[model samples]
Target: MNIEVSTANMKFLECFSSETRVRIIELLREQSRNIKGLSEALGIQPPIVTRHIQMLEEAGIIRSELVPATRGMQKLCILQLGEATLNFKRPEETHVPGCHRTVVPVGQYADYQVSPPCGLVSGAKRIGMCDDPRYFGDPERMNARMLWFARGYVEYRIPNYLVRGERPCMLEITTEICSDAPCSTSETPSDITFTVNGRELGTWTCPGEFASPHGKFTPHWWTKTQYGRLKTVRVDGSGTFIDGVRTSGMTIEGLDIRPGAELRLRIASLDTARHSGGVSLFGSGFGNYDQDIEVNLWYDHHNNAETGS
Candidate 1:
């Protein structure tokens, strides 16, 4: 739902310009409604309502499907947009140099030690039996789009592409994650820790396991968990930050990062944590935001020999 004010997105931006469409968005926000229902509510004919629905659908703001009803079937319109962000600023990469971006699938974890209520699922089907820790080692896990665990940790190794004389300036990792629950409830909270190269970055307490309104990209057949909050963990020269707010004083320098050094990332919900509500990770096909774990490494091409360059 992120967009910029540009001609390229004129269609999406136009969706908000009409009064009927705005009312339609508001109506769908409450719940999915049939075209006839919306037509009656808006005090308009079904033909006009259908036209508005078409606009919204073409703009990717809403979705429509036919369902069984008293007659034959009814066109049901569902709101797909949960949130929208208008970016006024330019992209960071446009101004920053010596930056490397990598996308790692959630199931590609190099190491893991997870407890029960754990399993992996691809976009199509479940990888193995649920609540079985052994399935984490399955070769099919590489195709997994989402995974959850009641306890313990999962680790990933990101290859550093920096060459000699390129000093690591900052590291950022973004992912969609939430507390793990049997199904899903907004009450549970989990203290999740992020570690880079064995150096603790910080701990973020995810509010809950979310399941309402459904994820924009989550498959229809999958119904265990709906979506997760997007989180960004950043480490720079000054400190570590979660979503722009400083969480810890751990700096990038402390990690002993250097050219050609492999970055190991660990996400853990330790048993000793105060709120051990478990963890669930969503990748491309199973979350509101359709993306995998994204890692951005910003560097400076300077001869910082002190950093072992």
Candidate 2:
């Protein structure tokens, strides 16, 4: 997940600053190793290896477990972090001109139709019960930081902040997501479609759910094996764009987000889609981006602007 350089994460950053520590991390990524094995492989003293292991463990970069050995139990070290990104600026510090933005937490979905292999989790705890559709109705769902479903759609309400004379010229929705492989990781693709205010925008095919390394921000308690990739989908006066490249002929006028109108954003794995794999949406404290579903509206304030509004 994204991390800003600050006092709060100084220890975590420091763990990766040393060459020796980086080597140890690389070794463990290949396979879990005990302290004695690490010392011999790195040609370092056991005490020195222990020190580095302690620091890495404290930073949540690796985890250790006592396992049975020839003579006694040995602490086995395993890499825990799959990836880490250092962000120069905090989320709020980054902004674009002429855009009105709204951030929606994944768990705050206004409406949803999901099947089995679906679940919700807050930053620190599971929302209710996994794979149970009834849990989606729980009030605690509003606090969700992550959600997944094998099929169907999740809809979010986008706040209509446009004033009397403003007209939306562009719309953008971005989030960290991946194919939802129930109980496992897979390279199978999934076709995810997007709709804005009931107007079909376009569909994106997610390559797969990654599990080789754990999500950077995923908590220690989370034992799930899938993580997501960050993606940005945009729809403007011209057409739809995925990660800056135009992918659809549908344009902003089709959305018809008039002044004072309510806006809804829906993401679904349509039954008609070629690849109906599944979907996992990640928000704060759950994915590589450590952010929520971001909706941006670029508007024209001129009363005489040609926007259909």
Candidate 3:
């Protein structure tokens, strides 16, 4: 599970502090086991293993189910979170001086064009009927925490929230996303493009949709086999970048994000792409990152003052 360290439950932290408990977690990572199996594998007493299991369960790190055994019922222990990250730094700790930031949930897109094999879901449940294009216009889409489409784009209107008289010098967008394949499995490559204020920023080719141990925060009710990888795309004076690597020749000037300009960002799986594998966007409580799509606008207040319009 992705947990902010500052606000993490004390009990959760305590679960990781003991060596025995850590070993238990390691063993479970290989596969689920009963208390007897865990004790035998770890060479610990049955009562000691039971105690550790209780602590892990209380921390939401593991869960147990009773299974019919040859003699009687046996409790099987399984790991709940496939991964976990403790973010020790707070938002302010990593804040840029001249940057204004905003976060938009994946489902809050202002406009969209999607093909079939598409659907929307909140953290708890599906928003509307799946695979039906009409549901894309449903008002409940605003509550969407996750959404996927086989092709087309989702547009978002980002408010220009920078200081007065300051124009953006750079823009960065980060989100956890993956290719949307039929049945959530595909090895096909898809070129995902990004546009800012109608200007083509860049395109990144997604290798494939991932599967295995589902996303840590992904709800149990949802039946998806895999989740997205976190990605950060940036546009600046030089060029566009994905995860700090330059991917496009397009520069910040091409976008023309002026002080009063209406800011809009669009993510698309173009029809002509080499791989029309589709796309899935994840938000809080839906993806591995446990965050929404984040946009950061960096500007120069001093430069604005010197211009003196």
Candidate 4:
């Protein structure tokens, strides 16, 4: 997760300030623990542990759920974050040039051709029957927060707002995704390909389907899949990169993207490809990250074109 290193994020930064809170994070990382278990481990009173847990939850560093215990119920706390990147650069940094950002929901795809073991769900309930490709066309799909498929492609159309003299320098797409394995297993790997404007950008091999006791934002009733890793695919003058690691020789210029051009992004799990496990996409209220698929386009003046970071 990326967070600005500003006073506005002191809430999250403060989590590491106290030794007690830091120790709590360390314990939670190994495994989920209930409040009673944590209190005993820390040798602190239950009220004190509860306060630390509250702070962690408010900072989005941890999540907790109420589960039935031997007597009544216990609050089980789980670590929510794997890693965090502190962005020191300010948002208004002028050296970065002009940029535009757009967020598209996982279900707001312009086109799709998926196979069975596919379905869509909102935070509350399922949109249609599971493993039925026909449900992809459901009218209520626009409200979907999570979607999965065994194979095939799902495409989204990104809006292009570049005016006359803006030269495209970079395009970045960020989303939470994973392999769509049956029975919610994480052992499968899938080679997912990405395309922009019909040009293949690159293929990323997803490690596997990710699961947890519960997602930070996902509802408790739903448990088929848990969460996914957040990935950022970037295309620039030099090459295409996934999370800053160059994955292909494809460049922004090769995509033919320009002012007022239609930007169609397609994600596919072709059957012919090696490790064609599947694909699962998570949006706001469905994954650890409370966000939709985000796209950012950075540009420079035609007269002063430079490489993008």
Give the residue spans of candidate 3 off by over 4 A. 1-97, 182-184, 303-305
Residue runs of model 4 more than 4 Å from their true location after superposition: 1-95, 182-184, 303-309
| CA RMSD of each candidate after superposition | 9.1, 10.9, 10.5, 7.8
TM-score of each model, in listed order: 0.69, 0.67, 0.67, 0.69
Predicted candidate 3 versus true structure: per-residue lDDT over 1-309, tens digit per residue: 346665457788889889999999888866678998999999989999999999999988887755345566478787764445676777566423378789998888899999988989887788788888778899988888888888899999988866566656678888888888637545656788888888887787876775545677888788773467666677777888775556788887788776656688998999998888888888998756789999988775555557675
Q: Per-residue lDDT of 158-258 in model 4, one digit per residue for the tens?
A: 99999877888888898988898746557788999899999888887876776654777888998777887677788888998775556789998898887
- Winner by TM-score between candidate 2 and candidate 1: 1
lDDT of 1 at 136: 99
Better of 1 and 3 by lDDT: 1
Better of 3 and 4 by lDDT: 4
lDDT by residue for model 1 over 1-309, one digit each (tens)? 357768888889999899999999888866678988999999999999999999899988887754335566477787765445676666552334468899999999999999988888999999989999999999999999999998999999999998887778888899989888856466789999999999989898976786655678999988787787777788888898775556889998998887788899999999889998899999998878899999989887765666563
How high is the lDDT of residue 65 in model 1?
Answer: 50
Q: Give candidate 1 misplaced runs (Cα > 4 Å).
A: 1-95, 304-309
Candidate 4 collision pairs = none
